[model samples]
Target: MILRRKENLSKVEQKHEKLKTSNMKWTTILLFLCFMGITMASAQQKTFKGTWLYEQGEKNGTIQLDLYQKSVENEFDMDGALCFGTFAFSDGSYYSIEEVEVEGNKASLQQVLDTEMGNFKMQMTYNSADQSIELSTNGANGLPDKLLLRKSDIQNQETSAESPIINEVDNETSSPINWTSIIGAVILIIAMAGYSLFIINKKNEFDQVYTTEYFSATRRSNGKSPQSSSEEDTQVTGLLDKLQHELTTFQNHTSGASYLVVLKKKQHKKCAGYLRQAIEIASTNPEILHDLQQYAHILANSQKRLFDGSYSVMIAAGIATLLVGYLMSDLLIVILFAGAIAVYYLASFAPQYLILNKVANSSHTSTGFLGTLANIVGNAKVITYIFDTQDTIDTITGDNIYRYDDYSQVQASVFIVILAYLVTGIGIMYIACWRFFRNFIMH
Candidate 1:
């Protein structure tokens, strides 16, 4: 009897193990199905790519969906395609759709106004059967729930036919960006930049060395008076005589500087140049040497004002161009600025550095043609500079201010200019760039 009872107990234990194994197998199958369901739902191809219009109890507007823009986001992360949208109500109220979360056919749309997440939530369900979307909203007064929006009839018929071109257009789907073109363009730009630099270096090679040796601060520190040679004295005196002749001959058409301003600057650079040569090789009187040095210093300081002003203008244009380019995301727009600004700016450097650097000024050899024409496209600063008559600071000391007195003034100007241009030139592009960067940095 004991042997029989032990055998029976072992059999029962084996039966219980089999039952547990069967349950485990079924649980595994169920979990696999659930996972697959979620995957399929999320991975399903979806596009709400047409203008959707709804008229439900006087809540009517068009929701334009750009098929080209795909926004994917994971909260507080910055790694998803931007979801682009706009909401225009019949009451002339327009709101931008800033956030989108989609799971299968359902999507939640969100927006923020004045730094606050709006109190309204719009949920949409895409109905494939009707090519329509059912929208539900909560937390907003007088908003309709279960609002149905049909695709525009043309879009509907096109969708029904399912032509690839029509579908792409109707959905506003854009192809992937061709990075190859952009890379090639950038490489070309770099090569051009290098070539420009090389050309400038080759053209002005000796001029640089000559100017630097004479005007360098080290020359100031040396303080060793250059003793005269008879030849140098004769040469410098001849130059001085010619300069005096030019200044005094005020009436004849002898072909010197045209404008009064040009006359003054040419006179200044010539005077400065003459004094420098004279001091290097003229009489050895210390008092005479000191006075020449002082006057030379004054002329040098004054002549530089024109170059300084032009340089300042160039710098401001550069900053504005960069800021505008950096803030814009559209490849076409960025390219436009890069090309125009590059041509406008780079076109001038050859003239400025190699040609007119010895006497850089606005009304002189450096300022008229190459850059100003190209830069006239969009730069406001360039516009002002082209028309600007003031070329010097008079003096940089004793209560003189350059540009604006405070940085806040600069900030305001930048902000205003950016706003104006964005509004006038790039309403849609601005929205697209803003959305792309917003998700990228703050997702």
Candidate 2:
């Protein structure tokens, strides 16, 4: 009886141990899932990509925080990580974070900070959507206070490029026009001319109505001799002639007109409106209606092509500037040149799209080509200046202020050289386009 009781007690103890192990396994799985969920949530938010500042109420005065991401490049593991930069801290202390972990919208930062008092282990939490940050210490020889930070969008400090020393390099030597770009530009112009000629030839030869074939088929179907249909055919031919003459006049007025002729604020829109009005008064003949449609299409296409070609030259000029600067080892010039090109393209394309929208509806809008170009050039200058001098800050408020010398004459000369490059490209392309359209008009 004693042996039997001892065996039963040992069996119960083994069973309890097995149950505890099973429970622990499940708990581990659940914890892992929770951790993965948090990681996924943080990724979805992309919580660290801008500037944050300490609020006015915080003891730290005029502290700025900027966070950005850098990618870790490894053959096996490719991922981006968050990095933080602390600027203008009150205590003149700075942090160099070693690790960052994100949980949902909040991110935790671990950093070793050296302050006036002493070195401390600091912890930070960032809330992305709220654009706020909370800071504390680990309670072991750390910061004595907690603080909050908010995003400062308006008075944001821009990082500026280091000023380049302007030595006595000749303008031509500093920014030599790349012969490769010139060759490329020449080839592009030739291609544009070839394509335009082909299109114009195709347009000239296109017989949308097949009037002769239709007339012949009609004669065969009716089995009518020349005498029988002569009277009716004469009247019909006269009417067709009159309609054809009218359409020719309309085409000449619209697509065949010169740039000087259509220098209005809404050139395409006005032309399209006139075409629509002509459509309403057009002949009922199927052939005449088809011709009208073809002419209208030609006008729209010609205008669109001219604008597209001009804008493309502007972009090409920008590309040329970039290439030349790169080859010359002028990094600052390259950046400014790239910025100007970007601004120029955006200014050209954006308004043109709006104008197209207006033209499509045969409505008028207030936009002109020269005016648009002027605005683009002006805006590009301002943007390029900001980009070149990012670290230099100037504001109406007295709190945060930094100043640098105004744009000098050398910069202006550099810009002129850039502009000249653009204009040369435009001139080449414009000549090609003009010749193509002249031939089209003659046809």
Query: Pick by TM-score: which candidate is best?
Result: 2
lDDT of 2: 0.42
Instruction: Give me the candidate number with maximum lDDT.
Output: 1
Q: All candidates' lDDT scores?
A: 0.43, 0.42
lDDT of 1: 0.43
Clashes of 1: 5
List TM-score per model, in order.
Answer: 0.24, 0.33
Candidate 1 C-alpha lDDT tens digits along 259-372: 221134446556656664664444443444444444444343332211212343334445545555555434454564455335333333422211232443333444432245
As a TM-score, model 1 comes out at: 0.24
Q: Which stretches of candidate 1 lie over 4 Å from their true place?
A: 1-63, 70-175, 178-181, 203-347, 352-443
Given candidate 2, what's the lDDT at residue 389? Answer: 43
Output the lDDT of residue 376, model 2. 50
